[model samples]
Target: MSTTLHIVLAAALISIGGCGDDTTPTDTGIADTGAADSSPTDTGPTDSGSGDTGDAMVPYVPDWSCLGSVTTGTPTAATADVTATFTDFGASGPAVGASIQYCPWDDIPCASPTDTGTTDSMGMVTLTVPTDPDPYWGFVVVELTETRRHEYYTSVPVVNDATPSALILNDAAINVIALVLAETQDYDANGVIGLGALDCAGRVASGMRIELTTGAGTAFYATEDGTFSTSLTETSTAGAWGVLNAVPGDFTATAFLGADSTPIGTINFRVKAGEVAGLFMFPTPDGAAYTP
Candidate 1:
């Protein structure tokens, strides 16, 4: 008995032949010779119409979406529970362990974030907003990958339940810090008397009345309790005060003594979302003016 081993490079074929029991060779179309057969029909990988080039090209498509239940109030509560679920485009599994952030829609320099957290094992996060006020339009950001891919969800509206108002995009919250002294004196002799009345420690004004209205004099903060509740007269306690929500633009603030209806000082200023504007009210020898 004789055995022959044949190796061919052109068609990448190997064959074995022997004169034993007349077994048919597995390498089809190859003669029972041990020489390399480099034929025209046996072209290598680049052979035309050979159908062995490679896998077909598939274009890359992004996978992203926000999944979960999100709700907003007419006048959003001071605090509310918010839940978010992140998933890939197919919505099959969670985008696990991603970073998430909630930015107030009205925040100027929109890059500034209001709240931040990370996704859980199930690609979900529950948030308890600490400073949520009425008209809470903002953005929710998800960092999808380690390569810095980002997804931004915008125009989320939230408002206080009691004094419900529609959320306005690009608007801001204004905090008015009032310094009320018992006397009509400059309190401090600085020419800028408003900055001089800085006795917020012991002389913190508890019931100083304040009002914020549109440039057209339409009062927006008319509630008595003064905490975004429209039914209460908004007042100050210990100099920390605020107009919970307002459109981003020009507006006027009026200050009065505790429980006094008379407007002692008034100032007009522009407000921006997620920003603080400071003003000082002093009832002094001069009639009424707000400095700073």
Candidate 2:
């Protein structure tokens, strides 16, 4: 997604992916990626590093050979049932009457909608889709309008016969979308966080620490209690991991297995203010964000 947002996602209100001036990226990787500098603070987690990003990263190429694909949730028959629930972190409780839809996982922006529905009084909806289930993965994308005063957006990777217990806001995720300071109003009013870790099979990975070799001073990592911290403990997760207060710019990032210096995955992502750019982590040695 060199400049085009490898994991680029565009919204009517916010363009979640892509860089306006990012030059084309030639190659990507690292060997001696130094430790990122971080300071424990109440605002969020921070990781400092000694690299500077200039060239755009190459389009995301999944090295899926070595990294396997998750097989458990694959749909076997045509037209499967997917259960979706929407909840808010603050006082609203559930996202009632919220709009929900089914989109192929490969399309990050959820540009295409195959099936759609509206959440009920309980803040839940079940949508059935055709048998073709993205051929690889299926996702339930949620959009909030007037429900929270600000437009809200979020997606959860799901499968046939499975229902997401809580696609709840404030669920603590590593990726956050904020308004790029300008004339644009910040749309992320609910502080919705999206988890972006996937196992070799493209499933959400358990836990790890993501360090920016040349990025923001602090990041927001989601805790089980549904709060954010910049501490080492928050760098780890049984769910999703993320960071914030990152200046809108290009930077190199490395993922390590909790306190271990060995690099598991290396990625270059761009975070523009007012955009929901994502730096999804994939297993290394084969997949470069896209597992082999």
The candidate scoring highest on TM-score is 2
lDDT (CA) per prediction: 0.29, 0.36
User: Which 10 successive residues of model 2 have the least lDDT summed?
Assistant: 42-51
Per residue, candidate 2 scores C-alpha lDDT tens digits across 110-143 of 6787678988887777777664443223444555
Q: After superposition, how far is residue 267 of candidate 2 from its true place, in Å?
A: 10
**Candidate 2 Cα errors over 4 Å, as ranges:** 1-74, 105-111, 130-139, 147-159, 167-193, 196-207, 211-218, 223-227, 231-240, 245-256, 259-292
Tell me the tens digit of each residue's lDDT in model 1 across 125-171.
66444434344444444455522222232112323211100111111
Query: For model 1, what is the error of residue 281's alpha carbon versus the real structure, in angstroms, after optimal superposition?
Result: 42
Error of 2 at 189 (Å): 13
Off by over 4 Å in 1: 1-73, 90-92, 106-111, 130-133, 146-148, 154-156, 160-292
After TM-score superposition, the amount by which residue 263's alpha carbon in candidate 1 deviates from its true location, in angstroms, is 41
lDDT of 1: 0.29
Backbone steric clashes in candidate 2, count = 31
Model 1 misses residue 27 by how many Å?
A: 74
Best-performing candidate as measured by lDDT? 2
